[model samples]
Target: MMEDTPSPIDRHITGLTGKARPRICYLATPSGDLPAHLDKFHAAYGDLGCETSHLAFFRQPDARSILVSDFRARLLEQDAIFVGGGNTKSALAVWREWGLDTVLKEAWGSGVLLAGMSAGAMCWFEAGLTDSFWGSAYRPLDCLGLLPGGCAVHYSSDSKRRETLHAAQQTRSIPSSIAIDDFAAVMYVGTSINTVVSWRTGSTAYQTYCKGGTVIETALSAKQISV
Candidate 1:
């Protein structure tokens, strides 16, 4: 059921998909949250001689048993997974309700390559920038905590977004967070981290947390988000 779609995310993780080294793939969801961000993902894997297995719909494989069986198990077959950027809570809810959390964790911890962006990446951090939206309906929830404590996605300057980040700071307490400037990514390659730029990439911005004063912009290196 993989279809062609456009992409808003810079597809930063794609640059690292080792072509010669094949691996199993698990592309994350909210495929709808985003409109057309699948084509790039597919092409990345195509270069690697791998394909993205959809875990989004497997949550309900069949009211008629028409989509085959054991769909969740099939997601675990790949060597790597690509988690898409979407609403963190919504995305995690699907996986938790469908049991993909246990599935992916076991798979990744046991060596399933974890490749993700936005919500996918945010899932790894401790506190996510959930309040950067124009609405005030949802509160903070526990993310997957797969990465360092502070970081956010599509984090940048714009009238609406700036206000959102400010509010997120006041309410959510994301003392320090990251801004992925439209076309940049702070890639995590184990303890050794770096940045990957593409398109109209801007510098990766970091807002550090101080005790009571304004948040400090400690060091805005392109890739050094962590200390």
Candidate 2:
């Protein structure tokens, strides 16, 4: 969501980079590199005292024109990469086709912080619940597997999210997953949860799974970050 004031989460992310002026990159692939999304990203991050740039897959002379080695080197130079929300399924297909999926893993392994909201966040997991299918109901879409198990975003804002995620688990369609409400984020360091934080009160994340044919939602402790 675009806000007149940057969210505290932005500050938190920047702080994680441990730099006074971090070099941050944006990936708007999921939104097909929509200009509006890119504009908003710059508007938000520009004032944060960091260098900001975006990689676009849908732009003219797109990723295909860039050599994989060069692309990897450019990404490795960044302190962090932030992905914007959009169609997860479509983004993944393009990323794989262009080998961005592997490059992202390399970036993370090299200590570049990986982050995003919605589709961006979901992509790092093994799978995520998505409504990207044009005419069908929400379903589980396999993801990059950078993080173990599955994920569900907008868990509180969208009522159907909880239902679909639980149902998927009940049927063994996805593994035990982390469900994050809007304005909340879960940080992972080396495949384990480092911390959970929320910019909005009452917004948090959950560890959701299926047991005995019933869905279980366990609230994760979240520290509220002041905006």
Candidate 3:
């Protein structure tokens, strides 16, 4: 977790759940559910007084290690689901096999705040610009569609991300999409943008779309936050 002075990241995420201290389930399937990644999540949210837990779907096919009757039951216990950034393609593959895709849809409808950057953020939308397929190039992949249109992350850090997303929008390969620079996030409250926030000052999100055969990139004003 990038530091937030007032910890607005924690506050906002927890706020979405209407809980002073949210129960957060960190899913690292996108990163193959790496132990280190899970450790990081535990360290970050745990520091903020969140009741933190995790779900791993790697070599353990049964998912029994999560200590729940079913994944759905485990998720229902959480007020928020945070996905770690990684190979979106592989994550979605395992999610479908485990029937987690539908489970997540149910979770979202029930008001479990969904969040993650990169693969985590992309999972909820209809499509996303990802490097998961080629590991280097941006490709638009159809996603869960919990949120409208498409999404992209690491806008400021990834060299090819902005141009690829812009071109995709111009070609109508994806819908009018939200592209978030590293350290910035767009909060979607039931398919509507609640706010654009960042852990770093001046980091921003963008609403990119096609306009008359050309791509338009509009910066979304953001509130700076840190913990």
Best by TM-score: 2
lDDT of 2 by residue, 145-174 (tens): 999999999999888889888989999999
User: How does candidate 2 score on lDDT?
Assistant: 0.88
Query: For each candidate, what is the lDDT?
Result: 0.53, 0.88, 0.82
Off by over 4 Å in 3: 1-8, 59-65
Higher-TM-score candidate of 1 and 3: 3
Instruction: List the candidates ranked by TM-score, beginning with the highest.
Output: 2, 3, 1
- What residue runs in model 2 are displaced by over 4 Å at the alpha carbon? 61-69
User: At residue 102, what lDDT does model 1 achieve?
Assistant: 73
Candidate 1 Cα errors over 4 Å, as ranges: 1-21, 24-28, 32-40, 58-77, 131-141, 157-159, 170-172, 191-201, 223-227
Q: Which structure among the candidates has the greatest lDDT?
A: 2
**lDDT, model 1, position 89:** 75
Q: Judge candidate 3 against the unseen true structure and give its global Cα lDDT, from 0 to 1.
A: 0.82
In model 1, what are the clashing residue pairs, if there are any? Answer: 6-36, 6-37, 7-36, 7-37, 24-78, 24-79, 24-80, 26-81, 124-146, 124-147
The model with the greater TM-score, 2 or 3, is 2
Kindly list the per-residue Cα lDDT of model 3 for residues 38-144, writing each as its tens digit.
Answer: 77777777777788888886645332235434679989778899988898988998889888999999998887878886899999999999989866679999999
For each candidate, give its TM-score against the true structure: 0.68, 0.94, 0.91
Please report, as a residue range, the 10-residue window in candidate 3 with the lowest summed lDDT. Answer: 60-69
